[model samples]
Target: MAIKKDMLVEKYIEALESGTIPWEKGWTTTRLHNPITGTTYTGINRIWLTFASYLKGYKDSRWFTFNEISNEKKFHPGEKWHLKKGAEGVEIKKKSIYYNEVEDKWYNSKQYYKKLATLNDVEKEIFKDECKVIGDGKGSYYIFNADEIEGIASEQIIEVDSMTVEKMQTIIENMGVGYEEVMQDKSFYSPELDAVITPPKERFKDEAAYFKTLLHELSHATGHANRLNRDLSGEPGSMSYAKEELRADIGAAFLMADFGLEFDESHVQNHLAYIQSWAEVLKNDKNVLLEAVKDAEMINDYILEMSKERQLTLTQTMEYSALDINEYHVELHGCDEGIDYTVFDNTYRSVDGGIIELNAEDTLLMNDFVEFIANERLNIDFTNYECKKADYEELMEKVETMCLLDEEYARSFNVDQMGYYVSEIFDNGEVVLDAHEDYRMFFTKDEAEMLSKELPMSHVTDNSEFVEILKSNIVNGLQTQSEVNEIYKKPDIEVLKNLKIDKPQINKTMTFGRGR
Candidate 1:
């Protein structure tokens, strides 16, 4: 299936409704990768796969296609395996893009454009054919996690020592951002003071909680006057406020993953409540969460960039993180007031959306905006093309759609991840609540004839939602209960090495949850 641009937002909506906020989940710092090749998944793949791993209790980080296992057997000549009887798989969009012969590497189309925009016209001309991506180069494929199959040895996970977590503290301390230990009960980053104020570490329930708070406040500091310069003027409960909160939560998650520390579960309850408050904005604005994640990743880029002392300890997914200018003469159009920065400014950034557009009218009003961008040591490319707001917006849409771009998953778990399930034979039915508590908790739902899979604590095997959807559809004389059964699809699994699995074909149904 073609992935929707709002795919992540749709998943977030379901997660919010289910009281299991996906972004709030704590994750390992290790980027998701194939243990077979030792190569990492980049961009959206990392974000989505991390969530998928969480959703299912796949403790082992290794995941691969059926073909990978098959190819391995050829080398070993003895070890044979198959996906555990009825084990499902997940699909990630895999696209082949043009090779940048100039760099002797590959980048997605947009990344190529930004890299090219930095060079002079001569350099740009040489890359016209060398760095283009075709629209037909995109498609989806299936892969099973190590936990999903048998006969394959799992990847051995090295337990990160205390020194690993301590590195986060050191990195944050060396960031040069202002800090204050308050006697007050609360902790926060003050934009007005350009400082992070938190209670002493002793005030927190655990060391992890204190660090999590620091990561969050520091995320806010990325918006400071001298840093990313994000607008922090929104009153609480406003859309801007909600977006900022979402951005901080996501940024903390990114940092947590890189540091390999699980988010302290102590604050999960409070964070869930906070997530509840933003439900309206998260539910209504499909693009807000996506925007927030992009912003959060940028926050991570800044914090990591500034903390080079411990850079060796942290890993970065540089595919979309680093900046290299290429020829653009690109532009964000001027309105009656010239440069509708409110819209075009953000849209102009090619890197992790640096604050190049920010602090311009404030700190650099006297300085040339273009010159400041030209001189700033930031991580993105810009030729400053003068396109209208409509044109700019359209261009972004096309780039994202054509390139399969943006904050980016795997999973053939049969349910729509709608937070429903069953618990053996209950008087209420064959399904019941699994008491989903936190994002980090994992469990199994006996999917004998229902959802036959191991799921996270967030998933209760309650089939009532499906039944309700089935009843509503049938009552309306549109779809039947049996038809709703097929809503959760079995994937079309194609092996990467051209080894396709002959899995049973499941008939289609009118999908009940998650919109396109």
Candidate 2:
């Protein structure tokens, strides 16, 4: 019989109730692999094996299906492989499908089966040319740990090594999140500090396990105020808490898959359990999965974006409050009289620059633009940036109060070719605010300083100075949800992209809470 999705969920729920969550224990420490293929499992299979091995207390992560195990092999030509002598097979549960033709329905069930292998002992002369076979090819496949097979030598089956400590460390360092290794046995993301904490690498069984656990916590870190903004304030075991776990677990899977990391059955099962635990709260909401996937995708992209934005130079290191917004380097690429920009946190303060493609006629405005930015810096603070737009009335008030300009003069300010009037700075250099098409203004501390001293003229219009002002004001800070919302949208998701979706084979009366 094959197992149904609902049954998998139920099993996970039971584990949660019993305080036997696979990830909470040492399941993540195991290095699971497929013996025959000499490859580590990945994605859902990774989670499934993690849970299975932990629950079964299997010491070795090596496993082989019945079809993959053989005492001796007699294939055509020189393509022959042999299994160790006295090798045996064990039965295990696997998913299978069944059809109820009478009711025109299909269902998944769980069943047991035997494994088979053939061997030839030429030295003993018991099976010279002919092969000696053991085990049976029962129905569905059932994976067996190598320990269950008698006389199965270690060399016959491959034991996958975890990724190197250095490699794992490098990946984590580049993930655009703060990471720390502590003496504690557990791992978690501290939203308050926007950092991830975990046990030392040596404490884990291997480097691979260490990274898997780290990835899980890193996924949670994506929900911080500066990142994905996933609400992690829910108390443990609450519906919101469960859902958040699912997001992190699933997000890790998506990331691992994209990074080409090897996952095992335990990964799949652990994630399934997480989903099951929260499925009730997420029940009938088809968008839950979609939302999680988008968040995970954003997290992945953000990591990559940060890596690209990093400009390494031998320089001094400065320390500031963890809550303080750092300087940002905004790179603007010219596109046929327009520009596209990439914004990321600045690691070095002294390195400030921008790329502007403007006609030579705009050169004079550049110096004035630089001075305007300097004066604005004297009067305003750009820390903890906020990305929002104010109404026209509020915009006028700020221009009047901060710039000391009259309403008529402020109203005469030249709108850019894009039709934007004001450029606002938020959180020091974290958020760049301007008049979006919606006519709302972003955070601006000194409206007069940000706006041109000659505001009644066309100085604010599209030109090199205006571009430099915009680039110079770019804030280096963690992107908020609103920032990500503007970057990636719902229309971007291809059917199953950014999600390790489990599409069960069973017939559905209603799939994804919608009639098909």
Among all candidates shown, the one with the greatest lDDT: 1
* Clash totals, every prediction: 29, 42
TM-score of 2: 0.34
lDDT of 1 by residue, 1-516 (tens): 323335645676777777776764525655667866776765445566666676666676667886876675453356676668776566665745667664456676435534443455675688866765554445767677778878876566755433244555565566657787878888887788778899877898877777778888899888765666567888876778878887887777777666555654465665775677567787777657645765676777667655544222111211111111232222332233333221222323243223233322333221254434545634334455331112344445434432221221011123434343322334533332222111011122333323223323232333434433433454333664355434522222231122211222111110211111
The CA lDDT at 345 in model 2 is: 36
For all predicted structures, in order, the TM-scores are 0.50, 0.34
- Per-residue CA lDDT of model 2 for 1-516, tens digit only, reads 333324444555566555444333324333466745766653334444545555556566677765555533521233333434544333333334444343233433211100000222232243221222222212334456665554455533333233455554555565557788899977888877778888887998666677778778877776665554557798877777777786676666545544445666555554554545655554555345434544554554444333331222111121110111234323323343322223323322222333334442333222232333334432334443332211333233222332332222233245434343433333574222232221122223343333333232332222324332322232212343344334322222332232221224111202322121
- Model 1 misplaced regions, further than 4 Å: 1-11, 73-78, 95-139, 161-169, 225-229, 305-516
Candidate 2 achieves a global lDDT of 0.44
Alpha carbon lDDT at 232, candidate 2: 77
- Taking all chains together, the TM-score of candidate 1 against the true structure is 0.50
lDDT value, residue 507 of candidate 1: 12
* Candidate 1 Cα lDDT to native: 0.53
